[model samples]
Target: MTTDPAARSAPRSSARRRNLLLVSVLALVPWSVQTFTAGSATLLFPWGLVGPATGSVTTITDFFLRFTMGLPDYILVWPVGVACYLVALGSALSGVLFGREDVRLTAAGLLLAGVTQLEVARGFSVQPGRTAWPVGTVLLWAVAGFLYWSRAGERDAR
Candidate 1:
């Protein structure tokens, strides 16, 4: 009985690419939610879990205003959000193109998670919804960590 190395490795490569794509999408969720909810009360209900079916326009607007005002203008800048989105997108692209995972992806994920934590801590007093960002950021970090750890294990096994 014999086995071909390429045949054995092909499935693993495909699985890795799929995992990276999934992680990239997961990482984008927070940014998408934040971007959509900005200046729009209708989007707030799902993202921030605020407002109700019968909620008045004033009520929704008030919540949106409060949430927006809670964060610093610098943090809310469109460029900053776009940059973060790009980083996540790049990480996914790198994972797909480069079979060998790099430490930078894990570092970037951890850095984003840390920043989100700081934002939550500083802004939670003003906007409770800010806490949700950490959930997505942490999930991104977890996936990156898992990928990094699994790769290391594979090297050891080899």
Candidate 2:
């Protein structure tokens, strides 16, 4: 049996695209949860200015209020979630369209994740029990960074 180089590479390319799509979808889960829970004032999303208004206004106002008021206890989870979602979407699209990873997208993801983690830790200091959820987000970013660094190292070696 004879095999062509293109045929050999096709499967690997498809697998990579599938992996990217999977990761992107998985990353959206937290964003969805965050968006839905943004109206809760007592539980996870407790950073409301006027006691959790209806709709996305609560998220928008809370984010701006927290930003301007220098309130470290209120980590803007919604914005962070949005950032995560955007980065994941961008990465998935780039993988599908370009057939390669986008370095800028990866870097943006890492930055957003790191900033979110820092904000979460700050919130944890004030509300130690309620802010632990973002640890998963931090870990995700850490894993992504590790993977990117390892892959870069391998490419450099070649």
Candidate 3:
């Protein structure tokens, strides 16, 4: 009976590759969510106050007028939003092509979650200002990163 070195090493190599892929996938979730949420707010929401832009047009308008007043003449963040969308689209395409589908999904998830949080915060505040929104954005990103790290470790073990 004999065992080849090449054969033994091959399994380890494959295992390592699989481990890397798993980690990438897991890491992608939070990033995607944050990216998606941000992108959505800029692209979808009329006011471009990223993260959970859930509110009536009036509410959204008020948010923009109150907080983002006189910053720029631009009414909407559509241009920046378009650029972000392209980046997200590219990230997704690259992830899929490189066998890292998780990255794409993660980005989307991050964006959505972040934007949703923003929306929620604004909706609740009687007179929303710039003060509270940044906090929400930071918290969402932190949670997303934490979740990604935790999930990556769990997935690799399997």
Candidate 4:
């Protein structure tokens, strides 16, 4: 290891940029999968796109997609959830880029999003299979947690 702080920081800077870029890309990832009893499904991405799914039941795609995706058929769906998701995405992005507390904001936003979606859902039910995991949400939170802890420790050690 060289005693050059600049050399050490170069890698750290690159890693930071990569991490932020990953966070941004994660927004395009499907945050959740809504499956129906009829063997059809839908993917709920953060950017508001719903694609067909092929898995066991977890959530009613029509209900979940109505609030989360707002497909053309769901033009009259509630807009508040989408707006909140946008806010959460912004917070998550800014937190990663500017090194701010993000988990809380993200958690809160997601909680609100779920509630709003639930509100619009008159009645729905589905059995979540083993494959029913929100991969993008899990990854984002995990990476965010790591970044938060690592950055905090790095500053404290400095």
Question: What are the per-residue Cα lDDT tens digits for candidate 2 across 11-62?
Answer: 6477557646645544433321221233343223323322334444344455
TM-scores for all candidates: the values are: 0.53, 0.52, 0.29, 0.51
lDDT, candidate 2, equals 0.52
Question: What lDDT does each candidate get?
Answer: 0.49, 0.52, 0.42, 0.53
Off by over 4 Å in 2: 1-8, 11-15, 28-73, 128-131
After superposition, the stretches of candidate 4 with alpha carbons farther than 4 Å from their true spots are 1-5, 53-133
Best by lDDT: 4
Q: How close is candidate 1 to the true structure, as a TM-score?
A: 0.53
lDDT of 4: 0.53
Considering only N, C-alpha and C atoms within 3 Å, which residue pairs clash in candidate 2?
none
The better-scoring model by lDDT among 3 and 4 is 4
Count the clashes in each prediction.
0, 0, 25, 0
Q: Could you tell me which residue pairs clash in candidate 4?
A: none
Model 3 scores what on Cα lDDT? 0.42
lDDT of 3 by residue, 1-158 (tens): 23897786565455445434433443223221222322433212323333445542333445556767554332243234334434444444455456343543444554544555455444333333322233434543554465456547656965
Error in Å for residue 23 of model 2: 2.8
Candidate RMSDs in Å, in order, are 7.5, 6.7, 11.1, 7.4
